[model samples]
Target: MIEWFTAVQVIVALLAGLICLVLGFIGKQPNDLTLGSIVLVELLLIAQLVVTIVAPTVGNEPSGSLAEFYIYLISALLLPVAGAFWALIERSRWSTVVLGVVGLAVAVMLYRMGQIWFVQGTP
Candidate 1:
């Protein structure tokens, strides 16, 4: 729910997505760089999870629908896992593209989550 933290997440997700997209386009297979970036993004998501858990108890409660925010958060958490698993299973450049897509998706979702937390009546 913290704006600065959400900004950080969005930036990292964007970088991850860009990196994977570039690698995929360059014909690079899924490797440590690609996988590691996804891992980094996932770590940030975990941090966001912790922040969301602690924020409410500390009086930084969301202004929008908590359920909607949580749904976005949970879905964002899943994308990287699914993308990484698919990359590992397929071991293809296209899998790298999939990871890129996942990263971008998480970024957009995080932005929406911020809206859901701070801007009421978002639809």
Candidate 2:
């Protein structure tokens, strides 16, 4: 649960959200650029997940409840995938809106994960 990496994830999520919202406002469906951005964010999240799992083994366990942290982690990991799938199926501007909303949600979840891991203080 590296704090800086978590911050990066949050930033990326917000950027993706903004991009998607702008595209939606302009009546554009999810395009390669939007989807690619989401994918990049997703990959960062996967790396975060790996670090979260490996950190505990290396004496960096989170202070918060492991179960709660895992819940947030899993949700953060899945949101982009689900949103992308929905966007592909719907093929409308609203699909981009859906992605935008999902991105925002992911950002919030990442922040929560950080609170769970760092703000609570090391155990």
Total clashing residue pairs per candidate? 0, 0
User: Which candidate tops TM-score?
Assistant: 1
TM-score of each: 0.96, 0.95
Off by over 4 Å in 1: 121-123
For candidate 1, the per-residue lDDT at 29 reads 90
Q: What is the lDDT of residue 4 in candidate 2?
A: 86
Q: Give Cα-based local distance difference scores for all models.
A: 0.93, 0.89
Q: Encode model 2's per-residue lDDT on 45-101: one tens digit a residue.
A: 999988988999999888888899999899888999999999889899999988888
- Worst 10-residue lDDT window for candidate 2 reads 114-123
